[model samples]
Target chain A: AEGEESMAAPADKRPISTIVIIIAMQAEALPLVSKFRLSELPDSVFPKGVPWVRYYGIYKDMNINIIWPGKDTVLGVDSVGTISASLAKGACIGDVFLASDVAFHDRRIPIPVFDLYGVGLRQAFSAPNLSKELNLKVGKLSTGDSLDMCPQDEASLTANDATLKDMEGAAVAYVADLLNVPTIFVKAVTDIVDGEKPTAEEFLQNLAAVTAALDQAVTQVVDFIAGKCLSDL
Target chain B: AEGEESMAAPADKRPISTIVIIIAMQAEALPLVSKFRLSELPDSVFPKGVPWVRYYGIYKDMNINIIWPGKDTVLGVDSVGTISASLAKGACIGDVFLASDVAFHDRRIPIPVFDLYGVGLRQAFSAPNLSKELNLKVGKLSTGDSLDMCPQDEASLTANDATLKDMEGAAVAYVADLLNVPTIFVKAVTDIVDGEKPTAEEFLQNLAAVTAALDQAVTQVVDFIAGKCLSDL
Candidate 1:
């Protein structure tokens, strides 16, 4: 609650004791970042002064900021700490949205792809008292800057039992878990991941579906969050 | 080093020491339990039949058995700590390999192409003492798995800045960084991250070059190990 004390009297331009850490694997990635900030939502989350409105457009009601660690988990972890610490963002409210391909699409790596999202989900869902199934299976949305050819990765996914493979997804999960956030992974299948023609065309074909999936998943969590928030109210 | 205490002990099938917490990412991956056997390294480093191996594959040393956390830094951290703390493995030597995607390729996620291997290298290399030009990149090495497009990954390696990406590479690096082990990510890029064909095809094309690069990189470190081993003798 002291977090509120410091933010309530903010001298400069910062939020009121609440901040969210949205980790983008690659900072230049616009597509992935746009998903979290659903434009059609009640109010646009896009900041007014930011010039990259077209590029950065924000997600609604989410106090999120982005950082690109360029694909290093250790550094990514450090970056998470640094970014939040720099913004003086509190660990109490720093939620992360991971951006990467392997995270949302299953079977990108040779090892059991199942464990890829499993670890993240397990860590996120296993946090204290939380519903394991319904909240996780449907509400947790996976985000990725790109997609994969599912058919190609499915075999590996089957082999490894992975649901998604986004570059930044796990890193975000790992960090958020460490910081203790009700981390939600909004994963959308961008590619078949079968290793066939995993191209922009493939991504475009799946974009809207994945985006819709992310949108629905985020909203689904509203039920759970509302319940939790109601307790506070 | 407490490792020296168990160094002379004979390998036994019986369990000894205490506390065995296996942080297996894949429940189905339980087969790894039977497949791996500790004590390939040295007795002092590990206890009885903990049945483990580093990262992947089997142990040739028979001195210690370690089930290396395959990928994902959190699990890697969890497993290493579990093993290190457990009486079974004891606090001996922590051998971990941060293996990730060696092949750099873009997966078509719903909206764009996400590069799977971009963050591993960055995570692995973005620390204090690791260097690619000097081939002295970060901490230790334990069992190795390279990206099939290993050669391509090496070719595409961009260290102009700090951290880069690889699949399992940095996961291991994180553990090593924590445990203070000199790590080597012997990754062979099976394919380039930006490729458009079967990773196998790219693997075929780049394997030779990748192997050479890996061999050279590994040899430099391996030679260092050999030199240390020889000096001790």
Candidate 2:
């Protein structure tokens, strides 16, 4: 209930009609594309030669678009949006977690007032009822572009009290916030950042199973979101 | 006339009313802030703890907002936006240049189709008349976070045919594109990327004079942009 006040419906109270799912990997996007029966739009939908891919379809009353921002790993968030989902580190494999908040671990602006800006913290949209109904783990998510954790990043992560770590979540949150759109993060854990096993090996090994779990959890989230305004979540 | 087709006014044809100038350094922002006779708002305009600074005032009919995005080197682009100006490498000191196009030199997605996405290329809003009127140099801009260029970055910049190098222009262009806002870039050269002197020395030596030159050029740009729609630029 800490963030419940901020969850009050906006003045417009428009019903959610369009849903965009931003996926970072082809492997993750493939399952959702098939499950949602999304048709791939032509490459021409984007400017010439950009590798971004868009898949769209109507699921019930919701218009759904799944975007894959190619292999370069930057997310282009152009959705009338909500829900930035991705695979996270620092949790058990296949555990589904909902972000309570998001911040950056790699960006450090050490100036007195600017230190806060360096972290770029943002709250995830509150969804208490839905979170309780699904029994999802809820905690802070930290992001950086690097897969390997440096000591400074570790310090930043500790400072942020981050329970989930990913390369893309905060970037998506920043964009979503800029658009005045509320966002909830649904992340599936694929590898433990501090575990003895190699990150790439564990990640690749668990990616498939985690992707399936994530897909199921997200589908339920979408179902819960249907026929509701943002505050309803 | 090459990019003229994309310059047609939108159906709504709303007259431009708000102008946001995103400056990375406080030194760069000070002169413009003084010239525009802007007042700094309380830090509370942004979320608590973020160090981003905003100075605003009416310049003629335009509501001008100049933002300094803290010391962390990350740009939080929250504006009903336009011009993204910054300092550049690869041109003579105090030379003001206008970006014809922008791209990232560091993001390389090597997959066959994804390679194009790796470049993240975008056109600067067409402004031939303004460029001609100001006698500004017009060329491609390549961006990356690092000031020190690697061999791969060099190759990419060459491939991009970059005439200027900076840390933030392409990113601003990317965000502006997502918002369907056209962006034109005006850059002042401080250090040559491949020049003989150490970059830091050259940059420090030239920054004050260059900032002055940049401030003048941008003031003229803002003046030219007044009383016009985006297409008019």
Question: Best candidate, DockQ-wise?
Answer: 2
* lDDT for position A112 in model 1: 40
The global C-alpha lDDT for each of the candidates, from Candidate 1 onward, is 0.32, 0.72
Candidate 2 Cα outliers beyond 4 Å, as residue runs: A1-15, A42-50, A71-90, B1-166, B169-210, B213-233
lDDT of 2: 0.72
Chain A only: list TM-scores of all candidates. 0.40, 0.85
lDDT of 2 by residue, A95-207 (tens): 89899999987655333344566578999989998899888989899986545455666778888888888878887887677555677888888778788876656766787
Error of 1 at B83 (Å): 18
Tens digit of per-residue lDDT, candidate 2, span B124-203? 88988899988999989988644445566678888998888887888888767755566788888877878877655676
All candidates: DockQ: 0.09, 0.10
* Model 1 vs. true fold: TM: 0.33
What's the distance in Å from true for residue B136, model 2? 14
With a 3 Å backbone cut-off (N, CA, C), the pairs that clash in candidate 2 are none
True contacts kept of each: 0.18, 0.03
lDDT by residue (tens digit), candidate 1, A12-64: 23321223435332322334445445232223244322112222324344333
